[model samples]
Target: MRHVVKEKSLEDEEEESLNRQRLTSARREALSLYRDILRATRFFMWPDSRGVLWRDVLRENARREFEEARFEKDPEAVTRLLIGGRDAVESALEKLAEKQRHQIQKERGDGR
Candidate 1:
């Protein structure tokens, strides 16, 4: 038996598709930022597993900014989201440097 979808359900599905498309478009601007965030998080996961605080903060800020842009319907907020996401990713990268420092110190101690 072939199942038929209700008209209302089809309409809802279309609306959901549109919403997803819009979200994808907005996120395209921040894709690089997201990748950077991931790289930073991975970098910070070494040695003593430190820098969790800043990494979490950057992640939260990036999430908040993206949500604001996705739902605010304001052009300015959308722009801010793109910029803020990039900045947050950079902040995460800076934290990664601290992780690198900790790793270096640990290696030096072991050598000594």
Candidate 2:
């Protein structure tokens, strides 16, 4: 019984350690995604007044989404959220790039 209890305690410690590592990794990924989204928002085209509004909206939405998932304990759920956020950031970046490209082409009279 003593030996069995010791083995179970060791196993529990290992599981706790793994959970901590996973949480740390998830936190880092979440922060990275938050930064990337804010960076991408800067590239969005808009007048000064509307630009501020857009930035605020984007930031608030991102903050709310992360906050809503702040208590997530499942590693799989965190992974899925990270993947989805990454895809969203990539899509936004691509859209920004395409918009800028078109703007430049139009200015050069090549978009006519």
- lDDT, each prediction: 0.66, 0.86
lDDT of 1 by residue, 22-101 (tens): 76776676676666765666544333346456556556666675555555665567667678767766776676677778
- What TM-score fits each model? 0.45, 0.82
The residue-level lDDT of candidate 1 at 107 comes to 86
RMSD (Cα, Å) for all candidates, in order, is 9.9, 4.0
Residue pairs that clash (backbone atoms under 3 angstroms), model 1: none
lDDT of 2 by residue, 29-73 (tens): 999998998887876546455556666677789999999999998
Where is the poorest 10-residue window by lDDT in model 1?
A: 43-52
Query: What is the clash count of model 1?
Result: 0
